[model samples]
Target chain A: MSNRYEARFSAVGGQGVLLAGDILGLAAQKFEGRYSLQSPTYTAQVRGGPTKIDVIIDDEPVMYPKTTAINFFLSLAQGSYDAFLYDLRDDAIVVIDPVLVTKWDEKYKTYQVPVIEITKTKVGKMIMSSVLSLGIMIELTQVVSKEAIEKALLQKAPKGTEELNLKALRTGYEEAQKLLAQET
Target chain B: MSSASSEKSDIVFWQGNEVVARAAIAAGCRFYGGYPITPSSEIAAVMAELLPEVGGTFIQMEDEIAAMGTVIGASLVGKKSLTATSGPGFSLKLEHLGYACIAEVPCVIVNVMRGGPSTGLPTAPAQADVMQAKWGTHGDHPTIALAPAFHREIYLDTIKAFNISEKYRVPVIILIDEVLGHMSEGMIIPDPSEYEIIDRVKPSVPPEEYNPYDTQYGDVPPMANYFEGYRFHVTGLNHGANGFPTTVPDICHNDEVRMIQKVMKDVDTLTEYDEYMLEDAEVAVFAFGSTARGAKMAVEKARQEGLKVGLFRAITLWPFPEKVIHELGQRVKAFVVPEMNLGQMILEVERSVHKEMPIVGVNKVGGVPVPPYEILEKIKEVLQHA
Candidate 1:
């Protein structure tokens, strides 16, 4: 309910990470029921390199679209985890793609998710891991409704890939449900 | 839209550049002259199309210099006219624009900024024009500028630009930028009962009693137009009140000093900004245009995580809003500036903050918004040190 929260997403190009961050920002607006302003800042590497996206959500008026110290860190690449080890909050909850980040430091206890392999093996190669990882992000926050996140995903994904992304999203969501049950 | 209206209306959603054109139309503007540039080209295009619709004439001048001259000439005949351009065009226009200021002609100038120094980035947004908008014109003359931070602010501020120009009988700049101009979103247009339109204060006394540059009341004088049944001399070479060319040394000094004093005395009313969270905070972000939107987000996210961050968005970027900035700088340990340019606004932030305090900048150039995490990193750094 506070007016500020900084969420950072890190990954490489083609990871659909930008799309995931954008959807969460949009969902935050819909969650507020006004024209919620979503200001995102990202890096400019065209090919393969560490790319980070920041999404800020608040109930009050937004003055600028940038922030620091991500409360939520979603790392879809090994580079993302390595990059964000120092960038996150002291107790920041990190969701990592276990396939990419095979190793983890003891200083930070992270949620290791086989996001890429599960997405590629079950959802097929044409789909991206970001869609699946978004399911975990939404499930974890519970701040935005699944429907709201889905609409944001539908609006953002490329022209022909929306359906597969949605399917991959559902598969990921079901996977998270199993994890939630196991933890409980 | 059948009949013409010289009426100012309430706030509404409109493109930043287009709002300048509408302001010109609402102020009884009868002439428009401009050379096109990105960000600001929309203003000229809108004027070219709509000016004729309102029974006014629109001219695309040869260059910024000619564009400025044409508007000045048009205004001399009692016409409210305007011109719109970007960084380079504005650079070409300042000399004549300065002439308009010294001559006390009523005209609106809109500069929709792109990145700069030279050509720079045509599509990128930058507020590098703030200081220039005030002092780019040569010599000491009163210049009024209004910067709109959103599409909605654009409409209201552009109308304010016209009113300020007409009320004082001088040139005013509708300083807008590329982000507000090109960004698109929709809103319901307002009905007519919302605005108070103003026109120049015309002289009601006899022609013989008039002094064009008289400082009797010391604000700005209302004299007859060149041929409005009264004769008045207009010159760029520093003239006398009797409508004749004057080279007298004291007269020149008085004329220059009077022009600047008029605006300087009323700078308080001209300055504008909107405060958020600064009423209770230890760190704040100062931003404008596209970068401001990003800063707003970062602040919100930081607060959710229990970090103390505030936002200060400048709706009117010119005149520098230094007082508000200085106040916040005194309370907050540091003021973070996030801008699209490499470091244009950071210089202003640094200038105002003035202490060994941490003044950070999250810059994004190459045509993209500054990412939220870049801001997050700075916030965390600030938090850790604190």
Candidate 2:
């Protein structure tokens, strides 16, 4: 593992991007025993506007909370993808939900997935797309342990919908594993 | 009061504002009066939910002024009270802030600062309120304001703000910027027994003999709460020892001097600062609030490149630690002051060092913190010129 790993989750407001960042930070800090800092930025609009959160994890304390160079980037919408694409490192790993982000630069390695569709079909709710994307993020980067992410999801997920969210997470993880195997 | 577990400490992930609410509750703060404002509204939200659970009172006042009024009134009745707001709301509370100062009410006012001269950038960060927190209320009265750099200090300094307010019988301000107010990190909530909670000194004498502002008891007279069987007057006017308004020159002068001395006399004990790698450094970075986070990283990176760079972080911004700055100024060849504003605290740094040493201001005003490289570049520029 690198000494430091930085990730940015970009989506429109009300897409649960902020909660995904929160769960990722809690997973690293609480269960994985790593130091992490999460800083979020959003507009005044409550929904349908661009929002982004930066999460920096490291073995040592994170001195600079904001991400200067991104190692992992997750884009849930085309607008957020275009807005934040310049911040990614040259060799950065980028994940896009193909339904929303149809166009992208070919310089960086990118994984295209139908995140919202999988959540709707497998989890029975479109709002759980952020959780599904989180599962894909863990499978692609292994930034945090799956068990740690699962524990954080259990702790943070709403009381009545834990089972459905867990199913969404598993479906996304399995789909990503299959895609990676085919590429190799 | 909720007790901390005696067996072992529990570590939890908390945002900076949440820590303030939790620490306030743990410090026995039972009354919270606040109006909603961004970057600080969460403190009021959490307090509203948590205070009622603990049998404490949480009030959503009509405006920031009313919030300040409610906090002062609650404190006068012997309840530990606080209010939280951002830049614009803090601007509105200055009238009552002065009232709390002259009336000598013990309360806490938290300012989670955002960019502005007005309702500027509600979502962005700035440290421009450094001077306003000191002289925002219009008078020459002494002020105690603390700035915390991270979440842990947010928790600890909030409790300290309450303690100092109770100890000196004055309003204590916890000055935090937008970044620290909204960021999330992990911290261990220490055992409650480990905290030092200070309550206001209650009157010991009979009702007729009690003088609320008596200097004979060494500047801080024991206070008597309303309806507590002691009838003592309170007002914003220059009051005598008996607590009633007094226009007599001698009485007013003494009252003003005593209020200032009560805090200025204890400057040594009240001041708090952290010095990093200053023992053999040629240049030092002076910063406070969220700016120090980037400054520390700059200092570490500069040291790795064989430049003798260190950091002097001020946790207690008011009662500005002039003594420490004065002593360090004598040894360091140059000082770099970095802040989110164009240059607020740099003026204080320049004044303290007496211009004997080179002072450079690395400032940013676009509602973002000064990057570490910018500070490092300034550090190197100063060293190269020296």
Candidate 3:
């Protein structure tokens, strides 16, 4: 695999998509000793508008921070999924919330993960869905190791929510592993 | 395990705006006065949180005008002061910026550019303010503006801005577009000894003998802080060596010329640029700020395609590196200027090269960045015509 990998996280403004990108970047740069960059689409509204963050993780220095092609794409909302689904590599791994995203291209490899449902039912917080999605993204891309993800996530987790966030991340990882086994 | 209290790591993923504030603190900037605006608010926010921790002060003033005024006021009283804003707020600060220019107060202003004629695109990135930065404050006053592309450069250049401002006793502006301001990246925090820190030269004479605008001490007179027992007049009008307003023809002429000459005479020392693979290249791409990041990639891609193209990325935007551009004009066959504006710095390039070679621009003002492929296509198109 090439040293450089670009991942995009998309959702509504209040959905914590940017925070997820930040955690992944922290994991790569601080824990994994890799270089990472993140650029987010800023919206005027505080909530309910489409927002996305393009993250690049590389073994070498990242010259151009903006992503031209995506290696891994995750979308938690239908509008963001539709708006940002264009520039994906041929073998790009696409992850989506099945309930939120109803449409997809059949030719592309797609994973339908119920991120919001999992966060609400298993992790006990709707906002934890972003962290949950980061787990799935890590399992698929391996951009940063699980240990690094835990260290970075716990560092960023809100007061008293470390165990809840870790539970959400571990649950997402296990679900993705089951999907990988089924694919084989 | 609470995020509210976490161990401090040596290196953290920081936004460009955040890094600017951290660097300002590291550079001994003790006062921040700013009116928060989109794409530049993070600088003010980070300063508000960190400045107090370091015994520095952060104040959110009533408006952009007051913000600039407070920064100038603070700087006059011996505090290394700073203020940040976007397009509209930058316009408001210009009047006071000129005041600081004439009064010879040392301060730093950061303009994190957003798309604008007036609040055109608050959250979108644009580089249209290139000319506005150089000529925004009115008159023919000298300007020193630094444009940094990445997070690390933002940190380094922000400190450099303070150094240049203190050393010259002139206001320095750091230009960052919305993309560079908001982008988050990894940057290693440098040790204090790794970079040179320059504070303004204090007046060596006694209080009675001190002159704020003394010309005998060469172009840059040793500055006296307001409360440092030296009382001197300060005004926006043309002033003499005593810092009082002057209407005398010779005194006015000499003072104005010196104000401009102090920076102009040192243009060679002030000019900082990146020349990538230009030694044997026939074409050069002139870019700055975030646009140069893509321009560098385009140069690499063109080199792989057997094209002789190089990138001249300007770190110092103002005092326009004319000498180097003139020298490069003699060697290169064509110039490709790509900017986020309709066309601003391209005019400077034309003036510097004196139209000696074919010059073209890949201009964009739609709040979208000019991608690498588009820049590469422009380079090829320019070469075909050349």
- Top model by DockQ, which number? 3
DockQ order of candidates, top first? 3, 2, 1
Per-residue lDDT of candidate 3, residues B17-115 (tens digit)? 999999999999999999979999999999999999999999999999999999999998889999999999999999999998888899999999999
Q: What is the C-alpha lDDT of each candidate?
A: 0.71, 0.88, 0.90
In model 1 chain B, the worst 10-residue window by lDDT is B1-10
DockQ of candidate 1 relative to the true structure: 0.09
Error of 1 at B263 (Å): 1.1
What stretches of model 2 exceed 4 Å from their correct place?
A: B1-9
In the predicted model 2, the residue pairs found to clash are none
Worst 10 residues of 2 chain A by lDDT: A59-68
Docking class of 1: incorrect
Question: Which of candidates 1 and 2 reaches a greater DockQ?
Answer: 2
Query: How many backbone overlaps does candidate 2 show?
Result: 0
Evaluated at residue B290, the lDDT of candidate 3 is 92
Q: Estimate each model's TM-score.
A: 0.67, 0.96, 0.96
Superposed Cα deviation of residue B207, candidate 3 (Å): 1.6
